[model samples]
Target: MDRMMMSDLLKTIFSVLLVLVVIIVSRNFIKILKMAVDGLISTEAILSILGLKIVLASAAFIVPAVFVSVLMVLGRMYRDQEMSALSSAGAGVGRLYIAVFKTIIPVVFAAAWMALYVSPWAASKVERIIFEEKQNIGVRAIAEGKFSEYNKGNLIFYVEKITTDNVMHDVFVQDKRENKVGIVTAEKAEVRTINNDLYIVFINGERVQGNAGEVDFVLETFAEYAMRLDSSTEIQENPITGIDTTKLLQTQDLKELSELHHRLSVPFSIIVLAIMAVPLAQVSPRSGVYGNLAAAFLIYFSFANFEKVSGSWMVNGEIPVWLGFWGVYFLAVLFIVILLVRLYGLAWVILQLKGKLV
Candidate 1:
């Protein structure tokens, strides 16, 4: 009978926590995307990007949200004397641990799956979509009479007209180089792809090149002149999500290993946090139902920051990977256990004091 009541209470707590997480995460996602749109991304494209980003961000935040939620609920219960009632009815503060674990164990497993598998898959898909969309944006903008700038404003191109045959007419190109300005006027132009390079082929054009106050040199082009506009930038491969779990295991790089540990820790941290929340939630009767929420948030973040620092240290070889990854979590568990014991011991001492005084 007690088990059933505890289960019902936990369900109510979980539901409230889930709702709070969704609202907070959604608001954050919208704010971030609005900033991106204002910064030059097309509204339509930003909407698509926002959708992809919010899902991944929300998934990542689940464990932390759960930790905060549990703390809040338990703190309220304690402040309201519900926990005192339970204790008087032969339930110890430690019993709350069992009830919390029942809900948190499965949540931790789910978080682990998301961090290990689902997050990476989502990241890859988002990248592919963004890449493809960005590649076509300039071409689409040109058709609508928009001036397109690329290569950090070194190149400016405009197309007055485009046909169904993929042919462009009345093209103007400007190239800016050190002490040199080149302007090319073409009667017609067409985009062509060769060896993975995009070239604008100009037909019957004239080029003028010189400094602002120097004699300019002019050249006339007849049949075809191709201008290469694409420059390759160095791309650093990310280990976090672009690679699969199997690949992560194969790579022996410290950074990759650190990331691997970080991913695996997310789910495990949920269980530790749930255990920790049970005792941390205790509050004085006069403190009100929300009394311990601020403290709980601080403690949760402190533990999270410790884990992050440990991961960084592991990557730098300042600590052993396995030990560094688990050390913070172990410390957190120890701290929680001590706190739980103290809370129970304090309660028992207070009862004896009251009995003697009475």
Candidate 2:
């Protein structure tokens, strides 16, 4: 690659990385700030979590952001006639691709590593830390007169009042276990931990239980009762994002297969965006560099959201695994090739020659 092209690519990549860090950090700071405001995390913990949040957030947006940044940077060069200088010197889009790809290769590698490994590790670590913190928090500040959900809404708790001494009054809990539903009401309750297990001890309470789909319900009254909470509510587990790729391949479960494909696609998307950005970066002579911003964003988000929807369908067996996540990516690649052939000078000539030959 020419020095000028390489230098340009490096400069643009550096600029893109800076913009990504700023935009992603600012956006996710709002979310982490809310956690601190709600007293779920301290200011110190928020600071710690900020780095992890950035990793997770960056993994999600990096592909699309790279596309837009590349478009703007390369588009600006073309707009300012810098690219024309190179073109007149006998350089083509292919040489431009060479220089850009040199820069993109390392970025794609880092992105793949983050998407496949670091992002999940960061997310999982944060989840475990938060889980432990909340567990230690231990119903200490149960909201009065408001229903609190636990274990993905499988368990619910409500307290009419909480005393200064940590005693709870008028406790109501609903437990939804597979095939069974239980509702318990008590005059008072308190949290107890035994050997790392949490329990809610109720006094003067009645319990009602029923099958999920049956009319028969059972009720019993007790002077005192204790119920253990086995739910840890881990945020990410067993999913392909958390599971090692090798381990994911050992299973044939549709959900897991779908997840594996989805996670695999995450890294693959970096390459896709890099390829797509080249031809898509070309702004018409009549339009400014920002003219294609809307189209670029629309194309990217549509691909991502559609892949998510298609992944869900694959998990549910509505679509076959072979044609799931890869299908969306294949379509993206096909679209990019079409655009390149139509817009990139030599590619267009080659396509026309092939058509004439046929």
RMSD (Cα, Å) for all candidates, in order, is 7.9, 10.2
Off by over 4 Å in 2: 138-240, 344-358
What are the per-model numbers of colliding residue pairs? Answer: 0, 0
lDDT of each residue in 1-358, candidate 1, tens digit only: 2465356545755676567657766786677576455443445566675666656775677776777767776776777788878889988754776777776777777788888888777777666655544554554445536578866787788888888777888888898877578888888988777786667789988887877777666566667888875633534344366567678888888887877887788888887887787777777889865777787788878988898899888888899978778999889977975786587676774675588799
258 Cα displacement, candidate 1 (Å): 0.6
lDDT of 2: 0.77
Give the lDDT of residue 136 in candidate 1: 46
Positional deviation of residue 15's Cα in model 2 after best superposition, in angstroms: 3.5
Query: Which candidate leads in lDDT?
Result: 2
Instruction: Give, for candidate 2, the lowest lDDT window spanning 10 residues.
Output: 231-240
Model 1 ranges off by over 4 Å? 1-43, 145-239, 346-358
| TM of each candidate vs. truth | 0.68, 0.66
lDDT, candidate 2, 1-358, per-residue tens: 3666557666766676667777878977898888777767655577778888777777766776677767877787777777777789998877877877777778788877877778768876787666665654535446788998766677789999988767889999998986689999999998787787888899999999997678889999999899887644554343345666566679988877776776677668877887788788777556764867788889988988889888888888888887887788789977987887678566675875688799
lDDT at position 119, candidate 1: 77
Note the residue pairs that clash in candidate 1.
Answer: none
